[model samples]
Target: MKIKSLHHICIQTECYKESKEFYTEILGFKVIKETPNFHKREYNTWLKLGEIMIELQTAKISTNLNKWSSLNEGPVHISFLVEDIHEAYEEIKSKGYNNFKLKNEKEIYKVENGYLFKVKAPEGTEIEVRDQQEI
Candidate 1:
């Protein structure tokens, strides 16, 4: 089967309020839709950033809730293409997200075709901000 495009990335979080605030307030993602009490005691929110969409879902089964870590075997990070890496980093820091650790000793690292830096969301989800333009 040929995939046309990425529809969305789904993230399950135990701290729903923190995750929601991080994505919406800190990262400036807009909420396209929200379903409160989606499955009784859980919330489901859809956020949009440019053409990318992310679905933030609260744990449906309490017993199955697990926290994410760098040691996890599945997807570890999500990267977004920003227009300016420095401006983006400054903005995030200015908004009191000072806990972010640089992916490299340098504030920005060079990729094959871009520059990138990583930051952890409130729940420790890795987020990479990149600019795909030669410096």
Candidate 2:
């Protein structure tokens, strides 16, 4: 079978409020829906950024944050296409959310069609922003 398209990316957050703020206020994702999870104790927030959708899931029970690591074996990162990588990177930095501290002169890498850089979400997930041009 062939995969058709991505429906959404689900992120398990240790702190739901921080994750929501980072995705909404920092990254500019809009909240499409918010509902209780299967257990009905915690919340699951559905967010939209352009055509991309993401689900922020709150842990049902208290857990150690140290267990989650960006370098873990599961889904490592999420990438987004931006109109201008430089402008996006600058905006992210100006907002005091540049956990990666990427330098434009060294960190931003050139791809076949554009440039790419990575930043971290509040939960420490790597979020890549790429700017591509029609060639």
Candidate 3:
């Protein structure tokens, strides 16, 4: 099978405005587009960080979404691209981030010319970081 880099990620947030601000402000991303999906009674927003784009979905229902936030977890997590994952880890750790402890680490999958790791973001959302390349 042929595949490309991660195209996009969808995050479900109860507070659309707050989540949008946090991503734009804290993550150094810019809002590119936003639309309302009446069928789901949700709001969809597109954000960009360099060449990568993230989709933030504000839904009225569970949408299943990320289990972390649904379970009252804090700080939704999204896997990030980095040149050196170890360095990235250190950098995040320096920011006083708590290491994400999960039940999996069984195998590191390699794709898009990079290794991968499943981590919980600061907000408790599960993020899968792959393609450790210089951004």
- For candidate 1, the 10 contiguous residues with the lowest summed lDDT are 98-107
| Local lDDT at 17 for model 3 | 77
The C-alpha lDDT values of all candidates are 0.84, 0.80, 0.63
Clashing pairs in 3: 74-123, 75-122, 75-123, 75-124, 76-123, 77-121
Expressed as tens digits, the lDDT of each residue in 52-118 for candidate 3 is: 8988876655565444544565544556766665665454445554444443554345556776656
> Model 2: clashing residue pairs?
none
**Local distance difference test, candidate 3:** 0.63
Write the residue-wise lDDT of candidate 1 on 1-135 in tens digits: 999999999988888898899999889999999998887547889999888999998878554676778797989899888888899989988888765656556767878887788888876788988898454
Best by TM-score: 1
For all predictions, the C-alpha RMSD in Å is: 2.4, 2.9, 7.2
Q: How would the candidate models be sorted by TM-score, starting from the highest?
A: 1, 2, 3
TM per candidate: 0.86, 0.81, 0.52
In terms of lDDT, which candidate is strongest? 1
Alpha-carbon deviation at 116 in model 2, angstroms: 1.3
lDDT of 1: 0.84
